[model samples]
Target: SLDLANGPSLEGIAILNIPSIYGGTNLWGDNPSQKKRRKAQKTKKDKDREFSNSSMSSAELAIAVQNVGDSMIEVVGLENIFHVGQVYAGLRASGKRLAQCSQVVIRTRKRV
Candidate 1:
């Protein structure tokens, strides 16, 4: 359950168990080109460290979704399409991983 707005008033309307993803589409503050340049300048070790620090693990994702749920809001403008794309990718990846794990568990249980 993702939401575009943030307000305590939405408590009843939104499911807090689902994290909200938001990004301003206006691109007023975002500078992806600059970020790319910075990333390109990093050494292998730096890249690894950066990814390790930023990448969310499955467990972390679950905890984050649970904790932030409805409270998580991203306010992006229409121009910030990339942010929305990233959120969709993350959601798809998480869903795929969970489905795979479920299938494995079910197969193991059936064998037992």
Candidate 2:
């Protein structure tokens, strides 16, 4: 249940089941040369540093949504307002794209 009349206080909230795009051969295309190029771009230490930094970074909150009406709603972070199928697009605008999002579902939990 939500009350939109008053201002929202969504802090410490959790969103689940958000759809996202995965980078793989299907999307990036299959090319041995590309693979080799990727491999050649980074040294082992560079790879290890990348891995270590990724592990240290905070996990992104996931959002899920279903088409309730006309808009595809998404619950992101602890925000009370939802984006209408624009989360993926927004991410894309920011250089991260979620590929092939057929549909979405979302869940919420409070941080303890």
Q: By summed lDDT, which 10 consecutive residues of candidate 2 come out lowest?
A: 56-65
lDDT of 1 by residue, 1-112 (tens): 2221321121112112223433322211222354554554452223222112333332333222222334442222232344445445553221211100111111222555
Off by over 4 Å in 2: 1-33, 36-87, 90-111
Query: Number of clashing pairs, model 1?
Result: 11
Clashing pairs in 2: 18-63, 18-64, 21-98, 21-99, 64-105, 64-106, 65-104, 65-105
- Segments in model 1 whose C-alpha atoms lie over 4 Å from true places: 1-18, 22-48, 51-66, 69-80, 89-112
In angstroms, how far off is 101's CA in candidate 2? 23
What number of backbone clashes does candidate 2 have, counting pairs of residues 3 or more apart or in separate chains? 8
lDDT of each: 0.27, 0.28
**Best TM-score among the predictions, by candidate number:** 2
Worst 10 residues of 1 by lDDT: 96-105
- Superposing every Cα of model 2 onto the true structure, what RMSD results? 13.2
Model 1, position 17, has a per-residue lDDT of: 24
